[model samples]
Target: MKTGVEKLTDVMAHFLGHTAIRLPDDVIAKLEELRDKEDHPLAKVIYRTMFRNQRLAEELQRPSCQDTGVSQYWVRCGTAFPYINELEDLLREATIQATFETPLRHNSVETFDEYNTGKNVGKGTPTVWWDIIPHSDQCEIYTYLSGGGCSLPGCATVLMPGEGYEGIVKFVMDRMTSYGLNACPPLLIGIGVGTSVETAALNSKKALMRPVDSHSDNPRAAKMEKLLEDGINALGLGPQGMGGHYSVMGVHIENTARHPSVIGCALNVGCWSHRRGHIIFDKDLNFTTDTHSHFVYEEK
Candidate 1:
């Protein structure tokens, strides 16, 4: 018989595996939209190949990208979650199990020792970020595979207040133009604005969790999102950087009020694969997922 945490571990492992093999519905929809907007034959061919790759991935039940990326979890848990105390360990074990079950590529290496942990659980492998929800028994989890090519050019800096929001635009555009092509085209861009480098950097990653077609709740931020998306598409990176009519799937901004003197901004990019999963769990561990809604998990 499995313990409560053990059951949760199996569920998480299954979800992680599911995430590796599939793209979210929103991402697929946007990709199809881009494919239709292009007139270039090569771009059309590339888009077709992309879909074929996804089809093969699902048919074979293999990861869509060999990189598979570093497994990271963004967990929003209620304070009253029954298994809250053991959640961290549960996640770590789940990652290890998924690494083998999904046959994921080993992507976690210790910084100085420089040895791959192999199990996907090391000193800080499978990085987990947490949020506490008050007076609820439900938890929301986002799992992402942060690939090296996409994450390599991630950057952050603090700007002088005088530079203003326009400065933020310049910073993002500069990075996208310089490194965006290498990240794979039709990238999902996440921009974070806060009071410091770390804060902005973290928020930038969180922005990637948003739906590709969604806009910010704030009107100014929503406008900025559209502006950035348009500017990036204007780059004409096309599919696989071969060049096309559109360059990005979308741009998302996650911002927080900063100190009066400084505006910190950071950028995180997600490649075409953009493997991530969103799952909500009740206290009893009954879970539902939107990212891989079509997936059928095998019961332990």
Candidate 2:
């Protein structure tokens, strides 16, 4: 007889294993669309290889990238949930299980010790960001499997108050020119502008959660989205940086009014595959699962 806590751990572990390797359907569609538009021969070849590799990964149920990534969970836990007491521990145990079950490449390295967790159970493995709300008994979770290659070039900077909005554009353009190619092109760009460095950085990552090609709610931000998209695509970094029709699949910007004295900004990039997904669990444990921007799976 399994306890609710045990069951929860197992369920999360299973889904993490499956989701970590699968590219969301929308991401797949965007890649295919780009493959058709690319004119450079080598870029085209890389695109085709990417598609075939995706298929092989799915068929074999193996990870699309060997670096199964540092598992990160964005959890919206209902305050009234029955197992609230153990949620954090459950998540950690699930990560440990998934690391080996998925045979996830051990990616968590202890900073001072510089040793791999070997089980993905280091100090902050499967970093979970929790949101607690009232009057609900269920949790809505988004698991983002972010690879280091894509995350390595993430940046944040504070502009002087006079830098104004255009300054953001210049920063993004400059960074992309220097390191964008390293992130595996056709990247999804997440820009965050807020009053503090940490908040801006987090908002930037949240921006990637928006659907591919989606625009900001504010009209001015929407315009910036277009400007950034056009500028990045013009770079011709293309697929795998070989050069072609599109370098960025899309750009999403998130912002908040800043302090009069400071301008905070951050940028995080997601590779072509952008592995992330959502699962909403009801009080009874029934759920609906959606895979990233593209893949969808239903459980009966």
Query: Highest lDDT among the candidates is held by which one?
Result: 1
The TM-scores, one per candidate, come to: 0.98, 0.94
Q: lDDT tens string, model 2, 156-260?
A: 999998998888999999989999988888999999999888889988988887778679999999999999999999998998888887998899999888898
Q: What lDDT does candidate 1 reach at residue 132?
A: 97
Candidate 2 at residue 257, lDDT? 82
RMSD of 1: 0.9
Clashing residue pairs, backbone N/CA/C < 3 A, model 1: none
Colliding residue pairs in candidate 2:
24-295, 25-294, 25-295, 26-293, 26-294
Candidate 2 — worst ten consecutive residues by lDDT sum?
A: 291-300
Tens digits of per-residue lDDT, candidate 1, 206-254, equal: 9999999888999999999999999988888888899898888889999
Query: Which ranges in model 1 have alpha carbons more than 4 Å from their true place?
Result: none
